[model samples]
Target: MPKLLVTAFDDEFCDEVVKVLGSKGIHIHGGNRVVSIDGNSQVDSVSLENGSKIQADMVLVSIGAKPASDLARQPGLRIVENGSIWVDEYMRTNAEDVFAVGDCAVKRDFFTRKAAPVWLASTATAEARNAGTNIYGIRVLHQIQGTISAFSTQIGGVAFASTGMTCRACQKEGFRYVTATAVAPDRHPGMLPGASELKVKLVFADRSGIILGGQVSGGFSAGELINMIALAIQKKVTVRELDMLQIATHPLLTSAPTVHPVINAAHQALAKLRAVGRELPPVKKAA
Candidate 1:
């Protein structure tokens, strides 16, 4: 088949497709995004805007991002470097009398232990609950994990999610990352999605080989995949811990926790880590 190539910033689906297509001898150019092969193509790139050209079969724009922050304009809020509002653990904004949540407020990075964006709805809700509760002498018993935070998302159908950082994310932060991926069926029968596939990619820090981020896609819903991964990130789950997950699965429901897709993906990430000669401790039991 003269297969068409695709690109997506949140592409856990494309990877599985490419694997299937590769085995079938289908012809497709796979990458972050498909660049136009012919010169007679419209172009767009930060570098391209500065005068650059890319020749390829087609161009697939996969920019993974969203609304940054608008805290800087807040009359009373302290604007941080990235235009995010500085908030205390209770998510209190500079006004002290006020609190910010979601995209508006800034939280600390779990990895670098620095102030950063906690823009996910998951984080937002948690911060909001805390901010609201804490506003009137309410003390949240759970001290939000500082420095490291996690998030999850599903794409193109199959469930995919990640916690912590991605290889690309780590590189931007000047941190060395180790990664692994697990490819398997979401069902025990394996033929349920005879036409469907599941792919998981997990990235971790090379220094500590700690689970940083993950992406999964396949079957029906991938949101849960990311959720579990987020927990892994919040608890700083190591590949070893993930390897020992006790996931509940109903062939039509999920992968066995003993061999959960997410956990397996961690194992895969572990292999990649070892290949680089980085010393990673045994997988920690899932908390």
Candidate 2:
């Protein structure tokens, strides 16, 4: 097999990624820039700003995307500083009867309310639902306020997923936060066929214990588990509440009830808070 190198500017969750990929002989280069790709008629090698050269068969670039707001600009629609068509929570644009959604529309961070450059088909579908219902008038009372940035991908036979604010993002936004992690087999019995080690890491506000974000890695179950975490974040579920969340478990399908990674992770966070002598407020009863 050919050696592979993945490069990135930041180390957001790269430790976890490296742990997974490194076991499979893949290399990660964080905090480095690709100075140049040395190639002739066909690709040859790549050079990095850190004075490193990597022989490569091919190079795949994933530098993210930008909004193609030219069409909206021609119509005189308001454009935000990030180059997306400005839209309200209901997906309504500044111009009357104009609505924009998806990649072409501006998005704000769910917690920070700052411009976020997240563009995903799932996000677009949610926006489309809001826009379609509200275009005739505000029929939908609940609307998307900001992008949660939920993402999931499979690599080297392992699934990885994350959503909402990461630890780095929280730090950058000046949020005091706590993080906890739990790991267990996906199936109740470690010896069960198809069982894989599922790991869950959750971040919460240090003071309120409200879930900020979560990441999951393991088997196929990680994909759906992260979605559940995303919903918990959207609902502002606190560690105390999440620790006591009710969930169903099966020997063949999920982790043991006593060791469910999500609940266990929340429990771990709660313990960390208590260890620090932080008094936690009672979980509010849902109205």
Count of backbone clashes, every candidate in sequence: 22, 0
Looking at candidate 2, the ten consecutive residues that score lowest on lDDT are 1-10
Please provide, for model 2 over 49-129, each residue's C-alpha lDDT reduced to its tens digit, 9 standing for 90 to 100.
Answer: 889999999999886678878889998999996789999889999999999989999889899899888888999999999
Q: Which stretches of candidate 2 lie over 4 Å from their true place?
A: 1-13, 23-25
Evaluated with lDDT, which candidate comes out highest?
2
For candidate 2, what is the TM-score? 0.91
List per-prediction Cα lDDT, in the order shown: 0.62, 0.85
Candidate 2 lDDT for residue 134: 89
Error of 2 at 280 (Å): 2.3
The most accurate candidate by TM-score is 2
Query: How many clashing residue pairs, candidate 1?
Result: 22
The TM-score values for the models, in the order shown, are: 0.67, 0.91
Q: What is the lDDT of residue 18 in candidate 1?
A: 61
